[model samples]
Target: MAPIINGRLLFNQLPNGLPVPGKTTVYDASETIDLETAPLNGGILVKILVLSADIYIISRMRDSSVEGRSSPFLLNQPIDNYGVGLVLRSEHSSFKQGDHIYGMLPFQQYIVMPPATAERFTVLSNDAGIPWSAYVGVCGMPGQTAHHGWREFSKAKVGETVFVTSGAGPVGATVIQMAKAEGLKVIASAGSDEKVAFIKSLGADVAFNYKTEDTREILAREGPIDVYWDGVGGEALEAAIDAASVGARFIECGMISVFTGEPYHVKISFNIVTKELKISGFIVTSLHQAHLSHFYETFPKLVKEGKIKYKEDVTQGLERAGHAIVDVITGRNKGKSVILVGEE
Candidate 1:
């Protein structure tokens, strides 16, 4: 039972725009624990291996008074999200040492899940030889967001056009691949030329750098987009609406562009009446019971077989987690942003 360093990132303050590492988060790695003797008290002690940093995390770092999609990050506490870890010691009957699990984990080098709380975690079996990082990206929450959104909301038919914003991101990348597999023409957008190139490599028929180009102009030229897989909202949504075909489907996953209180004046317009478009947003957790079984069974196989290639933006160490959050929110991350806390 030797002493082990326990490093964690705590939410320090809410940001007006993109958050700064030291200012927005307090990196506290001064704590130490004895892995063998630390009291679990009928719980499980885990060594966190991979920590997910998604754009949705920014949505949670607001004032507690303002109700939001997820719970607000409590100031001076660890930011909780999806993570993969290995059980080092367990007093719980269902869990034991050597088991790898994934759940809504705190951003720390180690964690102790109380008996009741440990019930929420799912033990994983990675026989497919997929990277542990994929569990936080293609095989975890972001993957579920895409898997469920496509099956549940997207009503795109074969030969139709499917448009995706943030096409280089985890959810958007998955949707683009899914649409391509289903015999649809894909038009996708990303904030940078590099991302647009990456999206095009994923079989998108048309990929554009949205920062320099006009969404309305491109959609007007190449659209009548049958299914709009939306990650960037505000003006992007307005453009999608303008380019949508009759009875088009809008799978609203994220609103990264407007989350930081940015001013956006784009009206939704009158197309909702004339076109009969179906715009739907979902929290992936809500759709889990209906779809998780199938998603876990099939999606991992697709990822392992290279049918769904995941683009990962991995930042090493718990120390850099705050900057990782910035990368995701500011669209600097090339794909699914993640903080690699440790090796599997």
Candidate 2:
């Protein structure tokens, strides 16, 4: 039997802050995957197509898993997040060869799992008229996060003022457009001048480079925001708190500001009390599961009708996965960070 060659990025050590070059090592697995072997009953084999590189994955790489944080990445193993793939073989009734799917897959070229494990993945619809990469980006976790954050947490009403941080990135871009589609006035912040223009192009009523301009000044000029869809936490969060309306809603999403072990102190606890604000933090996975039906029913249609737009920044080649992950964490990618591991 011929040995199946698999290349993967192995977690080398706990990142002290940002992932250093040597923190992860790329290597071909010693154990060869046997393609000729039949899968166990209720199991499937898949060839990974696209992989997601996200900041949340970085938070999990620290030595001790924060008490309330997601499961930490196992040391000396392939870093697992999500990916889009095609079924190569299956022993499960629900899945078969050539079926397109997306789910929490490891950063590897291929995977094999049991039925219970397969339940985490969803088979894609061919009629969706969207690209396979969309399943891992806009139509996938980031889209769901944007929708759920606004619908459930922000509960933003039409004609209200809304603010978003990291507005050029995937989740933030979606939030900006969604807020506009819902008739809310949007003020967004990004790290660079180009990102600011990109956010504005996405229909943000006002967009500014938070790195250059003061977030507080921007919000004050676009004052009394009713909802703050926070992506970059730290000073952005503080500015949101300061600029919040009396009964504003704060939808806490990513905290890229502190992803690298930096400290963030929101010196405005008094405002939370005095302003009678509603602040909520969420994990997109739980929200996605809770609202899977609605998301599948509506989000795709929106994408099809041109009501929703998404962008993907794809880095080609499996060998570049380590650099891709670093780029995403450090805000080097322009849109949703994705790695093309295989042909679509």
Candidate lDDT scores, in order, read 0.90, 0.83
How would you encode candidate 1's per-residue C-alpha lDDT over 1-344 as one tens digit per residue?
68888998999999777778998888998888888788999999999999999998887888999997699999989898999999998999989999989899998888888999998999888878788889999999999999999999987689999989989999999989999999999999998998998998999999999889988999999988889998988898998998999999999998887875566876877898799999998999999998999998998889999999988888999898988888888888877888889875
Candidate whose lDDT is highest? 1
Q: Which regions in candidate 1 have their CA more than 4 angstroms from the true location?
A: none
Provide the clashing-pair count of each candidate structure. 0, 0
Clash pairs, model 1 backbone: none
- Residue 286, candidate 1: Cα error in Å is 0.8
TM-score of each: 0.97, 0.95
- On the 0 to 100 scale, the lDDT of residue 35 in model 1 is 84
Q: Tell me the tens digit of each residue's lDDT in model 2 across 1-344.
A: 67578777777788777776555545456656777684566789888999888878877786655665677777888888878988988998989899998889888887887889997789988476878888877888888888887888877788999998888888899999989988999999887887787898889999988778888888888888999998878888898899999999999998887875468886877999989999999988768666877888888878888788877788886678788788888888888888888884
- Candidate 2 vs. true structure, TM-score: 0.95
